[model samples]
Target chain A: MATLIRYALLLATTAVLQRLLLDQIRIADVAADGFLVLSVATGVVAGSRRGAVVGFAAGLALDLMVLTPFGLGALSSLVAGAVAGSLERLIVHSARTLTLAVGFASAFVGVLFFVLVGSLLGGVGLVDGHLPVILLLVPATTAVLVLPVRRLIRWAEAPSRALSPALR
Target chain B: MILLLLTAVTLLTLSGRGFGPLDSVRSAVGSVLAPVGDAASWATRPFSNAWDSAFSHDDLVAANQRLQEENDRLQGQVTQSAIATEQLQELLALVSIPFVGDTPVAHTRVVAGTAGNFGDTVELDKGSDAGIEVGMPVITGRGLIGRVRLVSASRSTVELVTGGGFKVGFLVIGTSAVGVAQGDGDPSRLRGANIDIAQPVTEGQIVVTAGLRGSSFPPNIPIGSIASVRSDDAARQSTVDIDLYASTRDLTYADVVLWKAAN
Candidate 1:
């Protein structure tokens, strides 16, 4: 029960931060990938189930705020959470390098998937001129955000665990 | 089991058959989350405004004085021009083209934007109560911005030309070649496609909205100017790069055109 509440809080906080602070910061003309980073952190700390739940909730929240087709964010975040959770089993410690790598990789795949799906939906026009700029900014912004997000997840998760004796 | 549920929800949403359960869930969640989005946008407003004010202070002051003088001089000219234009429009109204009604402009406050992607859509403070509706064209003196896509009681979402889902039909200035101008998910860039290669389009040619059959937008709204043209020899199609005239980065208020086409 405590773990569930923790996951819920984490999801809510992630959504808030994504809209507030993280969304505002633009590095290399790209805002930091807050939800992606949060998903990876939750997936790694908790099991895949928790990761999936958090991702779904966060993605759904994002979709509601954004004007895109409703399910796009949920689908992408679900995949991202599952993949990150699976990778967490192989890694022992939450080193900065590992987090950075995960952040960069997930950010890349997430953005690419979004663009591909968006293009297929017949709303966006494709042009070669801005592709290079997008390519450079996506990963770099993700890489810079890993450590801060890792710390935030830990902080947010600690309170829920404290409230639940079972978690202790 | 979880994946199955997720897939089911996704499929339902993609089909667009109106998912009541999901929409309720979204609205519930949005209600909870809306404050956060509002706070985020609110926090940034001051800084963005301050930065813009700093950069444009001298020029803006100078322009304001010049504009005052120009307005005084152009008052008579405008009256005469309005009469002449109205007469011409009345004559042209005889043609079977859909008539665009007079539009009233409204100013709105920005609410939120997309966080992750290059596209920056804004939620406005006005909605259905203010006579704003979906498909209403948004513009500034410089050029076209985008259109209202979604609306709530007190809020509306504008999908700027930089957003993924924005498309407009435009005409090139020199040859009047008509093509489709669409958002590239980047504010600074636009793409004009399906222009005939031999249309005499050139670099720096201004592009204006070419109202489609039954389109909500009026004819000849400024869109952008052509930057480059790419022609494929065998495909018989060409693409033109356009620089959007609207500055999405600094936009705070916009004019929501409330014109409806008279049948």
Candidate 2:
């Protein structure tokens, strides 16, 4: 219950920030996605299963806010989180390098999946010349945001850590 | 993971099929978040303006100078009162569409724009409570901008004219030619295809909405001006490119013209 409440607050806060501030801060006409960064960071902090669960919830929250097809954001975030969490096992102990690698690769895969799925569903404008710019920027932006978002997720999960028998 | 994926797929399928209950859920969520979004926007506006000023100071200065010159030119043109009044009415007729006469318009501020990379859309701060509904034409003083795509209790989304698959019926000024302009995923252009090769179209010719029976928009609403005309001999048709009059970027406020398509 505590975990659920913590994640809910985190998702709500991220969604608000995305709408107001992050959406306004555009670089080369493409804005950074705070939801994607948070999901990827959660994956880096937790494991693959927890990452997928959090990612899907986060995406669903995002879908409720945007005008896109209802499930697109959820699917993108879910896969991105899972991929990033799965990579956690193979990453070195250096926190900086791990977050950056996971953040970039996961966000890239997530956005690619979104475009491909959206195009197949008759989203004619989804795949355009500006795709290269989106591909370059979304992941790069996600990487820059990963470290801080991961720390926040870890802080939220601190209670769960304290209650775990192994930690005690 | 499998369970979650299945859930997402289910949601996509239900939403694509136009499930009505989902819209209620979306609206409910929007209602909950709208206030939070408004508060955040109010608090962060100063910082946002600062960021814009820091990056685009020179551009703003140039724009201010251009507006000053335009103001001076208009002031000089106002010479005699009676003549100016007649000309003012004529200018008003030219700028405002006749077919949109007395239609109740709901004015609202644009709260947000394009949430993701895929679509060209913006969100307005007023919704059904303000008499704004899906399919209503949104405009500024310049011309038509887009149509309302979705509406919640206090917010709505508009699909801009440049969004893919958007089509508007238009008539060429001073000619009998009519064509449908289609958006092809380009931000700054619309294409008019299958136009008769013999049509006398040229660069700089203005285009206005047809607003014929069953048309989406009202008649005489200026859409754009022709940028280029190409004759495709093999297809036996001419294609015309248009440059839109009302830009979609940086729109702060607009009016939702409350005329329905079927009406």
Candidate 3:
């Protein structure tokens, strides 16, 4: 129950931040993907089921906002979160490199999955020509931010874990 | 069981089947979440305001001076106001569509945004209780921003034109070059496709919303201007770059175009 509450709070907080703050802060019209970073981080720290659950919730929250056919984001995030969670199993140490690598890969897959599903919906076109560039940049960008994000996630989750016996 | 139930709910909604419970669930969730969103927005409002203040200092000063000069010039034109008012009255009389409608403009504040790298949406502080609904077109003095994608009782989400899935039919002012403008997931970048090669397209051409057949958008609303145009023989279709007139960076408020087409 405590784990569930933590997941819910984390998901809600990230959704609120993405909606309220991050979207306004653009550098040359590019805003950081705070939710994606958090999703990956949550997956790495909390394990696969929790990660996938949070990712799905977050993505569904996004689907409610955009015009795209619903389920595209939810599915993509679910898959990305699961992959990140499994990756955590392989790495013995949750070092900066491991976290970054997982984050970079997950972000790339998440974006790609969304684009592919969206294009198939026939509602609008993807930035098909820039796919390669986005693919390259998203992972690299996520990787660069992973260290700091990992630290923040650790700090936030530690107290919650201590408070909740289920976290053990 | 929870995953299965969630998936079932999601699938049902996605398939266009009416999930009666979904609306209630969404409303309950929205009301509970609205305050948190509002508080977050309030916290960040100062930072954005500070950024805008610092960035627009010089420009604001120059603009103030220019406005002062323009005011002086416009003072002379005020003498002909009687004649202009008569002309305006005549034009108003000529318009066939009823200007008066049920839709009332309600101001809303930004509450939140869509999550992840697909950053193309913002949440508003207003919701169904405020008479907002999905498909309501959102705008500002500059031009169109987007439409309300979803609404709860106390909060709503707006999909901006900078999102990947947004598309608007547009026309290049001087030429009959019609194309579809799509968001490049970046506000500074927009793409217009389906232009005919023979059409005389040029840089800096004005683009306006080419209202679709029986669509809600009023025709000729300024959409953007062509930043660049490209033609390739291989593709047989030209692409034009558009620079949006409205800056999402400085967005504060938007008007919900409440004119729903009469059935």
Candidate 4:
């Protein structure tokens, strides 16, 4: 129950931040996507299944907030989360740098997936010569944000484990 | 993962097909979040403005100079226009005349500047409740900005003319030439085509809506002024670039013209 509430709060807060504040601030017409960064950070801390679930939920919330089609964000985020989680085992040896690496990589994957899928679905302006700018900005912004966001996700997950080890 | 993928696909397909419930869901979500967004914007606007001003002092100075010159020029034109208006009014007293200014409009505030990552659109505070409907043209004091793309009970989205895929018929003032202007995925200018190469279109010439039969926009809605013109020898057509009179970056308010194009 505690984990669920934390996840709900995370989703809501990220949605609000993405929609109201971050979207208003643009660097060369491309705003950093905080929601995408948070989801990728979630995958960095959690395993594959949990990561995919969180990503799906995050995508749905984003879809609801934006004017884009219903499932574009969802599909892109799910793929990104799952891919990031699957790479967790390999990066466990380099655990010290895990969050940063996964954050950048997963954000790259997520944005690429978004552009490919969005263009296929007839979305305009996704490839209007800003693709390279978006690709670099989204991931670099995610990389800068990964450490704190990862800690937040871990903090949200930590209480549940302490409350019931057997439940895990 | 497969189930989630299937669900996402189902949603994409359904929404693309214009499923009614999906629209309702979007509206419900907007209604719930609009106030929260407004509050956040109000709280953060000062910081954003300060950040912009800090980085853009030189640019702002240059822009101020440009505007001062333009203002001086326009003031001269306005005086001439006033004289012409008086003359035309006396002549029009002989017959009844309907003017574009007589069209009903709903003045609305822009609640949010840009909504999503994919396209350039702004959110307005008024929607169907204020007679704003999809396809209605929106304009500011400077010129036309865009058209209403989506509307809910109390809010609506206006797709800016700079958004890729926005196309509108336009005519060059003082010429018989007409063409279609379209956003080229750039926020600063629009690309125009289908113009006859022989047409004497010059830089800084005004462009206004053609408002042909079955057009979505009403006639004489100012879009922009020609920035450049290039002749396409093979096609015998001229490619014109238009610099918009309205800047989307700092839009705070606009009027939604309630007039719809006649079929």
Candidate 5:
């Protein structure tokens, strides 16, 4: 329950941040992919299933919150979450550097998926002549954000696990 | 993964097809989330404002340019006022005719902004309950913005003039030429069609609503100013490019004109 609430707050905060503030703050004329980073980070930490859940929720919020295609965000997020989770399954846990690597890679996968999917969805010029900048920003921004986001999700999930058997 | 992926694909298909049944769902979700979106904007207002102030040197410079224009206009207004007063005093010696009438109008605030880069609509705080119909024009002090595209009980959707499907009958101000201004799926660029080849159109010529009978918009609202004009000799018509005065990027409020087309 605590984890659910924490993730919910995180999703809402990220959506709100992206929409009202960050969308206006353009870097190289492209908005930073906030929800994608969060989804990828969550997937890496919580496993693929939980990560997909977060991605789906955030995607739905994104669709409803803004005027993009109704299902595009959800689709992109689902893939992101699943990819990160699959990566988690391959590596042994508990190495800080590995976590960061996973985070960066997850972010890259999520962003690349969104860009490709968005373009294919008939977004015509969805690349907007800024694909180079966007591609560079995606992994770069994701790298910058991965560790912090992973930490936040970890922080949120930690107490729940410790208190779980005790409280129930 | 498969199930979630399938579900997402189905939803995407339905959304892309614009299935009518799902409109209510979109509206419901939009209605539910509207408050949250507003709260987000409200919370970030101060920060965006401060950031724009502190770090936006280019914006500040552009703002100064606007201020300079406003100053010159205000100075012109002072001269016009003095001239108008003298004219009014002279007119007092003659008979006066006062004309007055009111057009139907319903003022509304913009509730939510464009959805994304591809967003072509804006959500309004007013809906059918306020007598906003699907075709009523939306306007601001500057000029025509768009028309009502969708309306629910407590909210409505406005199709900005920049939408791919949007078009308007436009008159080139100070010239006899008229043309159909249309959106090219690019918000910043509007294309004008059917401009008579013989009509000389220059850059920066203002355009306004034709207000033709049976049209959605009323007459004489400014649409945009001409940006470019090119003659297609084979077609015997000059293609004119227009730049709209209203941009959804910074819009926060609009008025829903209650006027309907006269059948």
Candidate 6:
């Protein structure tokens, strides 16, 4: 389907950006998580299942460049995307403040979940003592990304679905 | 979503248990993306540099002033080197001992570093094809970087000293203080524990590699400087903190010591 191909391209593009470009752009030594933003954005517009799937694919692509357990990245992005996507049920607006709020919250919460899971799995180093910055940045980045991501999802998804009442 | 989570958890468990398939997946994925990552890294370098330069104007001014002072000092050293060159000929005749820290090395540019915030590894442009091997210490002009961890024909991964898995035998320079220093997941600092109780300690002292028996690093390679020293008399030891001199944020190139020569 066109949707699948579209998401596949997005996944690869974001992964490449995160792995190659954004990784080097550290603000205060903390690199912005590009995949996290896209994953949350996809979930916000495409609904939970698609969001989770896109996030997992993106996360797997990310795993190739990182040293975490094979699926750890997948898990983090999956939870974030899934939870954020599911929020579409509560709010009707797909491409506005509602989606941004969900995406921002998802990015922040998902990273917290990642750190918590990492700590439990003996990856305490993953926390890195920059909890405040990481937490703040994830959502801060999400805020910047929401509008662009919404437009991207609208272009990628079926026109009718994208143009539904909630999104308008 | 639940099923996906379960599947991901399963994969993590399997990888943690050392599953071969997972290794293959990781290797294959890494190999496939390494080039892409390399290209991307190479392409974005300008933006990264621009961002840093644009933001660090004051630091640049200070650094420029420092460089001016160093240039003046080096000119003096150049003058002294000519006179010292005459004495060195006589000293060389008297002593045939090898000089410390004169090892031959290969300088390579970093292609791709770890993408996220957590991992402290980097991909080098050179690899086994260039005679870079595992266990070789990587350094920059400033100080220690890390060591080669994984290698391929044309690319290799350097596990930075700040990585969670790295540990180094540490020594406080110009003093008898010795201890174990390991990364605390922060690139700017290392945690030093179990300093010898008898060795006197103080703030702002330099720290270097102890390079004890069986240690990978050569003796006395500068690592960082002591930021603080706190004593724990009950445990008969002191904890020291080291401030890393080499900034990982700006690390662009490193020299790999081939380790064939002791010096």
lDDT of 4 by residue, B21-41 (tens): 887787788788888778877
For candidate 5, give fnat to 2 decimals.
0.38
Off by over 4 Å in 6: A1-3, A24-26, A92-95, A154-168, B14-31, B34-62, B75-103, B112-114, B173-177, B213-216, B260-263
- Relative to the true structure, candidate 5 reaches a TM of 0.71
Number of the top DockQ candidate: 4
Where model 5 places Cα greater than 4 Å from the true spot, the runs are: A1-13, A16-30, A47-50, A87-139, A155-168, B52-103, B109-130, B133-136, B147-159, B163-188, B193-204, B209-220, B232-238, B247-249, B259-263
* Native interface contacts retained, candidate 4: 0.61
TM-scores of all predicted structures: 0.76, 0.88, 0.69, 0.86, 0.71, 0.80
Q: Where is model 3 more than 4 Å wrong at Cα?
A: A17-21, A24-28, A32-34, A46-50, A61-68, A92-94, A123-168, B1-31, B49-92, B95-104, B107-116, B123-125, B154-156, B161-164, B167-213, B218-249
Give the Å shift of residue B228 in candidate 2. 0.9
Deviation of model 5 at B141, angstroms: 2.2
lDDT tens per residue, model 4, A1-168: 778878889888888888777787778777888777767877878877777888888888888877677888888888878877777756737564666777788889998998888778887667878779888888878777877888889977876755466555
What DockQ number belongs to candidate 6?
0.51
Model 1 residue B50 lDDT? 94
Per-residue error at B201 for model 4, in Å?
4.7
Cα-based lDDT at residue B152, candidate 1? 59
Model 3: share of native contacts present? 0.22
lDDT of 5 by residue, A1-168 (tens): 777778888887787677666665667556667787788887888889988878887777777655456678888877777778878789975676776676667766766676677667765344544556666766666667767888788976777766577657
Proportion of true contacts reproduced by candidate 6: 0.66
Sum up the clashes in candidate 2: 0
Error of 6 at B211 (Å): 2.9
User: What is the DockQ score, from 0 to 1, of model 4?
Assistant: 0.60
Strongest candidate by TM-score: 2
lDDT of each: 0.69, 0.83, 0.69, 0.83, 0.74, 0.77
- Chain A vs. true chain A, TM-score per candidate? 0.75, 0.91, 0.79, 0.88, 0.81, 0.85
